[model samples]
Target chain A: MNKTLHIALSGLNAIDSPGPGVPVARGLREASGFDFKIIGLAYENLEPGIYMPGIADKVFIMPYPSEGIAALKERWEYILSVSKPDVVIPNYDAELLPYIRLNQWLKEKGVASFLPTEEQFEERQKYRLTEFGEKYNIPVPESHSVNNLSELAEKGKHLGYPLVVKGKFYEAGIARSPQEAEDWFLKISHKWGFPIIVQKYIKGEEFNVAGLGDGNGETIAAVAMRKQYITDKGKAWGGITVTDPRIMELTRHFVTKTQWRGPFELELMKDARGDFHVMEINPRMPAWIYLAVAAGQNIPLATTQLAHGEEVKPMPSYEPGIMFIRYSWDLITHVSSFQEFSMKGER
Target chain B: MKINPNLAINDTGFAFDPMTGHSYTLNSVALEIVQRLKQGQTEEEIATGLADEFDADPVIILKDLLDFIEILRNYELLEHE
Candidate 1:
């Protein structure tokens, strides 16, 4: 048992739209095997996870990813000089690019992180999801990128009506017509920038599986979920773990095929015919990750253990039917502390 | 300008307008400006105070303040006036 490892985590937004850090940290805290300090890395001072008592021993603000990779290095180098975390787990997709670039640098600095290679990241992107599915022989709904509204019709002919239009990074909207698709294309493109992805809308049950890859095509642990209640923003407000051999089989195939090296959430749909259609691949852990721990996988714990070079046996079975109901908590804080964190960049 | 009476804000930058049941996540600067607005500080006074505290042009700060107020109104977080 590692007695004192400092683990740094990012993406702590626990709002309507959440980041996975808080729940991931929850798993680490509940880990029966290790005692560690939780270092919260936030891009904004009010990320909610920073202010939540018992979640973060200390919190530090980081430069937004838009500031680019060089700035990321300088900022992280500074953060490391002071706190020197044993392992860093970034829970946001936007931070993955910079983290992949910083992987070797942090390792040299004695900070460990498990992440997918740059190639895996790119190939799994929405625009390339179809290509990835084709390469892996996995079933994926056909998707194409549209740079402008003019290109929507041409690019979306095969996709058909009631398709899903998604931003390159974050926003996604279902468009029932060309007009709605065009409107969403404009909205998403305006918000997340260009190269919007238009995908075939598969009407079925959405199942999400959160898993950790052992970097050599083996899945360390896997937990599948079915949302009992979906919020207006398309987030799962309540979900239950499920025992699906096919989803488990697909997860094994995916991680083994990609030699995936980190935490991943596979958003897949099961059509009437019982075939799994891969909708999207979230490169990091999902916000509902605590449920994985509740279901007995303890993926965050596995991830930290993997980062520390500990041998983790493959967790092949988990007690299914465990459910997680998401809720929002109000954390009372001080204006002066917020100001200090903002102006001084430490909390 | 004043914050809507039914609106509630937390130090963590969470704002909820119970009247409309809408919530917003404010940045630290926006929260500061919103707090001042709730205290009934005028735009000019808020801008001057911000400029004194942070390194920014008062004019730009006021302009940004107005923009923030406009956003507040759009979200129905501010009074009609």
Candidate 2:
């Protein structure tokens, strides 16, 4: 028998807690022929074994002595020494930069790192992926990168009311008018710095697809899910399996066109024109990963097998029209916070 | 608990209860337990059969079966016998 492939998932912060990553790991372990282990770098107390059973084989907690790139590098070195995984997959956007740096170090250490190249990373941060979509005739919203508040206001007016103001690299806030867009831009700029993108809000049904790409432009398995409900933070609270062939083909085309490697999720919104506009590409797993396993694609397992150069079988067809009610533990929590946040007159 | 005789369950795990206008999705294991319950099997007998079939501990199987029955009761899919 072939040796079991070992993998490590980084970034165990509170934001991208073990809650999300654990399911993916567990699904992989159950479905694929691999021995998966999660290496949580910070807050060992929040390790995977505590919450998620049968997912993490070993959890390595690194020293959290300080906060900075230098301290993080030290922790990475410690992690590399203790858990010598064949590949490292980062789980959060904030951790991407440091993991990229660690990837550079891994190249010298003779360990393979799975992440986008530096140039590709920079392009993604600039929303240049939209241009790639446009090349392949993938519908993208009318969006423009802006550097100042005046430019945001100008574009917002041009795009009309109900615009979405987003950071060039990440989700920021969705606003109803030019003033609201400007206010959102100012607030985010003050807190996280500038260069945001403002786009016309494409109103209609939204859908997201999760899949794994072979890096050679072949998508292994893909699952389409239509959002039945959404939280204010854009998390899918309820969804259902969709068997739309068009959505699947579009997702495959886009991922292949980008030559994307690793697990990816594409967010798409169907406009009033009945055209699907590409929203954004999350280069990691979504929160609803368990639903995918429950509905049957098992993307994390497929990705792990591909990473190990093992032959991955095609995903078996599953029943469509299956609805997933994401038990909303935090729905009440969000409602309370929204009330308090509104009372403060803050968006 | 009681199951409405009018309710129909398909082999593929789809359950339709006309009395409540509610449909349910049950895994194969849950479906099997529900079917046996509807066949008038006692809780202990159902647990014993499930334990033999799935190679699970009898106590754990009984607990899980009871929980499933409670869930069905809560959904109004079952009534007290």
Give the TM-score of each candidate: 0.80, 0.68
- Consecutive 10-residue window with the lowest summed lDDT within model 1 chain A: A319-328
**Model 1's CAPRI class?**
incorrect
Error of 1 at A21 (Å): 0.5
Q: What DockQ does candidate 1 score? A: 0.01
Error of 2 at A3 (Å): 3.4
Q: Relative to the true structure, how large is the alpha-carbon lDDT of every model?
A: 0.88, 0.66
The pairs that clash in candidate 2 are B2-B79
Tens digits of per-residue lDDT, candidate 2, A1-347, equal 15655667644332322235655665666664555555433344434232334545555544343355686677667656656776666666656666666666765654555565555456555346456556666778777788887787788778888888887544568898667887888876776566787777888778888777767677777777888777776777777776666777887787677777777778888766547878877777776766678778887666666655567765755445566665522212345533543343111
* Model 2, C-alpha of A47: deviation from truth (Å): 7.8
| Number of the predicted model whose DockQ against the real structure is largest | 2
Worst-scoring 10-residue span by lDDT in model 2 chain A: A10-19
Backbone clash pairs for candidate 1 read none
